[model samples]
Target: MRYLPLTDSDRGDMLATIGVSDIDDLFVDVPAEARLSGPIEGLPTHASEMAVEKHMRRLSKKNLAAADAAFFCGAGAYRHHVPATVDHIIQRGEFLTAYTPYQPEIAQGTLQMLFEFQSQVAKLYGCAVANASMYDGSTACWEAVAMAGRVTKKKRVVLSGALHPHYAEVVKTMAKFTEDEIAGGLPSMQGSPDDAGLIERIDENTSCVVVQYPDILGRISDLTEIADAAHKKGALLIVVNTEPVALGAIKAPGEMGADIVVGEGQSIGVGLQFGGPYLGLFAVRDPKHVRQMPGRLCGETVDAEGKRGFVLTLSTREQHIRREKATSNICTNSGLCALAFSVHMTLLGEKGLRTLAAENHRLACLAADKLDAIPGVRVLNDAFFNEFTVVLERDARELVRDLAEDDILAGVSLGRLFPHEEALSGGLLVAVTETASEEDIDALCSAISENMA
Candidate 1:
C-alpha cells in the first residue's frame, strides 16, 4: 500500500504555495555531493509481506541467538530472568499504551509510577533525588559531567580508566560538541579498579571525576578516597554503575559521597533485546542542583481535598520550557522501560534484592574458581560481584570466535575493545548471572579448556 498521503494535485498545490517547482527544490540548501542522484541501490523497491519475512528469516539464520548458545555475554547488557508478573504489569493497556505524562490530571498513574521510579533509583544510588530517566547509561554519564561543569564552572572532567569504553566514548562525543574537556582513555584491560593515577590527575580545573562502582570488570573498590580527593580540589565525584544489580550487595555510591550517580538499570525487569530500550538511572546528592538534573522528575503532593497526587515536578529539557535555560537537550523519558524497572524493584524489596544479589555473587564465585582452575587461565578480580576478567594463555578474541563455532558463546574479550593494548589481548571478560546455571558454567569451562588445549 502507498504510505505517502499527498496525491499529485496536493503535492503540486503545496509546492506552488511554497514557490518550489518540485520536491528537489527542498534540497537546494543541501550539498550536491550529499544528495543521492537516484534511488538507492541493493534494496528491493517493493516486496510482499511474506517475501520480506522470508528475506529477514534468511538473514537472521546467519547470526547466533544468545539464548540458543551457552551464552555469557555481558559487557553492559546482562541476561536476567525477568519475572512473568513484571511483564504482565507492563503489558496492561494503561501502562503499555501510555506515553510521557504531559497531562498530569489524566496521567496521574504514569506520574505516580515515575515518582516511585525516581524514589527507587534515588534509594538504590543512595542519592537524594533522581530524574524520571535518560536515554541510557552512557547519555546519563555525559549529563552528569555536564551538570558538574555547571556546578563547578569548569570545563575539564577527569574520567577513571575503569569506566566502560562505550561510556567513555559517549562522554568524549558530548564534550566534542561543547567546550567541556575529557581526560583519560581506555581503562585497564585487566579490569583493575585501582584508579590512583586518575586521582592524581585532578586539580582546580577539574569539574568532576567519573568512576565506576564494580567498574566494567565487576571489581568493587572504596570510593571514599577518590571522593575526598575530588572534594579537596572542589571537584565533584561522579559514579557510573553499568550493572545496577551489584548495588544490592555493594555500598551505594551516595553512601561513599558521590556528587552524582548514573548507571544502566537494564538488569531488572528488562531483557537484552539484542541491545536496548534500556533504562538510564540518574541521581544527585544535593537538592539545590535538582533543577540542573536532566530529563523529567515526578513529585508527590496532596491536592485540595488533601488526597495524595503526583505531578511532573521538574522538567529541564529545552522542549519543556525556555530553550536557552534548559538543562538538557534530551526531553523525553523511557516511560515503559522505567515502569518495568520500578515494578520489578517494587516486587523485590530491600530483603529480596539483597538475597538476589547474594545468589549472583555465589554463582560468580563458583564460575571464577572453576575457570581459574584451568591450567592456563587466571581470574583477574579478587573482589567482585557477578562478573570478572580472566587472563588466558591464548588470544581471547581468537578463543571466543573458536568457541562460538562449537555452539558455545563465551565471554567478551577486553582486548577486542582495546586492540592497541597487548596486555589485554589475552584478557577475556566472563559474566555470571542468575540465568547461568551450573551446567551452563561447566559447558563454558569445558569449551574453553578444549579450545585452548
Candidate 2:
C-alpha cells in the first residue's frame, strides 16, 4: 500500500469514472499473449532488494554475452567501436540530468546538441533537413509511412521485400488503426540484390515505396531506378536504414532522390543494450515536408547581441491544435541517445568514418569469403556494406543453436523471422564489422564448417 499509495476504493472509483468494469479494460488494445499472466516468472511478489539484484544478475549471465562470444549478431543492430569520450560527455550532470528543452533560454545546451545531431544525421542521409530524433529505426519507419500518407494524401504503401521485417511489422502495427494498405513483406532471399519487381508494383494508390538501403540481408543497390520509378508515379521514396555508418562508404539516399530517410543510429555512440533505447534518425529531402516530420527539430539563430544561439523549431501540427490531426504522436526525441550518436559522429569526422566504413567492408568481405569456402554455405549478396546473408545446406536455426553450444553466436536465422517461408528455411544472416578480427571470422568459419559436416 505504501508503494502503490492507492487504495482499492481509489482504483475502483477511477475505473468506474472511465466506465470500465476493471483495470483489465485498460489493456484491451494489447494482445492477450503480450499481457502479464498473474505475475512475472521467478520474481516473487516480495523480495529483498539485495535478493532481487542478485537474481537479475544471474539471469543476465544466462544470455550469450555479446562481449565474450564470437558475436556476429546483426539483422538491424550492429557492433561498433564507441569511444570512451562519447560516454563521458553524455554523462556530464548538466546533460544526463536534463530533460527535454521546454524553454529555449535555459535549455540552450540541449537544443544546440540536438541541432548538431539533426545536422549530422541530415548529412549522413544526404537530406535537406532532419528531425531531432524518433523512437528507433523501426518506429521511424512507421512515422515515415504515416508522414508520406499525409504528404501525398494517398492510402497505400508499397514495401520492398528487402526492408527489415521487424521495421515492416512496426509499420503494420500502426497500419491496424488506419485504412492504409501495406503491400509486400516476402523477403528477397538469395537472389539479385535488386528487388525482382518491387518498383513495378507502385501505382496511383501508392503514397510511398519503403525500401531498405543495403537491405536487411546486407545487399547493396544503387536505388536510382527505384527512386525514379516512385517519382514517376507521384509517390515519394522512403528509405529505411538500420545502420547509419554505411553512409560513409555508400551513396547517400538523399543523393539517390529518396524523399524521406529514417533508420537506427545505434551503431554510432550507442551500444546494443540487448535491443532498445537505440536512437532513431529521420531526415527529408523536401523542405516542404518538414512540418509533417515527426519529433522535434532544432534551428540556429542570433540573439539580441547578435551572438549565436539555438532554438527548438518545426514541431508537428499535431503538437498544436487538432489533437486527432497530430503529425506525430511521438512526444519527444530520444535526447540522450541522440546526443551520444552526435558525439560519436563528431569524433569520427568525415575521414574517420570513411576509414571505418572501408574497414567494415573489408572485414565483411573476408567473412563472406570464408563462409563461402564452407562446402554447404553460399554468400548471397553480390555487394554489401558490413552484414550479409548466406544460404546454408542445413537449417539456420539448428546451425545457430549448435554453434552456440560451441561458444559461437554463428548468425541470425531467416526462418525465425519468416517462419512460414519454406524458401528461407536454411538462410543465415551474418554480420561483420570493424570490431570483428581475423580470429573471429576464422573461428566462425571453422565452427560452421564443422557443424555442417
Candidate 3:
C-alpha cells in the first residue's frame, strides 16, 4: 500500500489530465496478444519477503554460473576475470552510492571518474571524443544510428549482416519511432564479413553503415574500406565493438575511419552478471560531432582556485535539455558499471590490456583447433579474436541444451540467436577468454564430442 500510493480516484484524475480514458489506453500501441491478462501462471501473486528470498535463491541455484562450468558462452556479454580490486574499488561508499553528477561542484569525484572513463573509451575506440557512458552496448548502438541520422540528414541505415543480431534489433526497435529504414539480412555462413555486400547497399539516402568488428561470428574485418565507401556516399560509418578487449590487439574502429565508435565495455571490468547492467561506450571520431552525441560528456577544467577539476562539460540528455532538442532521452548512465570498467581498464593498462587480448586469442585458437578436430564440428572463422563459430552435424540448439544439462556451459547457438533461420540451425558460437584454462577447453571439447557422438 505504501508503494502503491496512488488511489483509484487519484489514478483516474491523472489519467484524465493526460486525456486517456483508462490505463489500458496508454498501452494502445502494444499488440493485444502481447499484453498479459492475468498473473503469471507459475509465479505467486504475493509472498512474504523471506519466502520470496528463499524461493529466488533456490531458483538461482538452477542457473549454471559461468565460473562453475567449463564456460564458453559469449555473444556480446563476456565473462572476463574482474580483479577483486575492481570490485573493491567500486564498492567504496562514495563510488557505489553516487548518482548522476547533477551538481558538478559537490560531485567532482564522480565527474572525475567519468572523465577518466571517457578518456579510456576514446583511446580504446581511437575516437576524438567519447561520452561518459550510456545504458548498454545495444542502446549506445541505437543512439549512434540516431546521431548519424542527425548528422547526415538521411533516413536509410545500412547494417552489416555480421552485426550482432541483438544490437541490430535494438536499432530496428528504436527506428520504428523515428521511421528510419533498416537494411540488412542475416549473416552469411562464411569465413569473412560481407564487406562488399554492405558497401554495395550504401546509397545517397544512407545515413550510416553499421558494422560490428570481429562481428557476431567472431570474424574480424577491416573497417577502413567500409568507412571510405560510406564517406564516398555521404553516409557515416558507425562501427560497433561488442568485445572491447579485441581493440587492444586489433585496430580501433575510429582509427579505421569510422565516424562513430560505440560498443559494450563488459569485457574490461564488468563481469557477465547473467545478462546486464553492462557498460556502454560511445564516442565520435571528430570533436565537431560532440554536440550531436548522446549521454553526458565530462570535460577537464580549472576551478576558480586554478585547481584541476572535472565538470559536466556537456549534458545533452532530455533531463538537462528540452525534450525535442536533447540528443537522447537516456535519463541516467551505467555509472557504477562504468566505474567498474574504468577501474578494470586502469588495472589493465595499455600493456596489460594487450597481454589480456593476446591471452584471449591464444585460448580461443586452442579451443577452435581442438573443436575442429572433433568428428562432426568445423571452425568457421579463418580470423577471429577470442570467439569463433562452429558448424556441427547436429542442431546446435539441441546440443547446447543437452550440454547445459550436464553442467557444461557450451557456447551460444546460432539457432537460439536466429530461431527462424534454418540456415543457422547447426552453428554454435564458442568464446574463449583468459579465464578459460587448458583443462576447461579439454573438458568442453570432450563434452561436445560425447554429445555429438
Query: Mind giving the per-residue lDDT tens digits that candidate 1 earns over 131-185?
Result: 8888889899999999999889999999987788889988999899897888876
Clash totals, every prediction: 0, 1, 0
Summarize candidate 3's per-residue lDDT along 314-351 as a digit string, tens digits. Answer: 66445556577787778788999999999999999999
In order, the Cα lDDT scores of the candidates are 0.87, 0.88, 0.90
lDDT, candidate 1, residue 379?
Answer: 94
* C-alpha RMSD of each candidate structure in angstroms: 4.4, 6.8, 7.0
Best by lDDT: 3
Model 3: lDDT of residue 422: 89
Worst lDDT 10-window in candidate 3: 313-322
- Candidate 2: segments with Cα more than 4 A from true spot: 1-55, 320-322
Question: Would you estimate the TM-scores of all the predictions?
Answer: 0.88, 0.88, 0.88
Question: In model 3, how large is the Cα lDDT of residue 408?
Answer: 84
Report the Cα lDDT for residue 438, model 3.
97
Expressed as tens digits, the lDDT of each residue in 1-453 for candidate 2 is 235788999999999999999788899889988988687788757877788799999999888787788889899899998999999999999999998887778889998999888989999999999989888999999999999998999989999987888888888888989879989767666546555488879999899999998788888888888889999999999998898889999999999999999999999999989888998999999888888787778899888899899987655464665476778777867899999999999999999999999999999989999889889999888888898899999899888988898788877899877787888988999989888889999999988888886
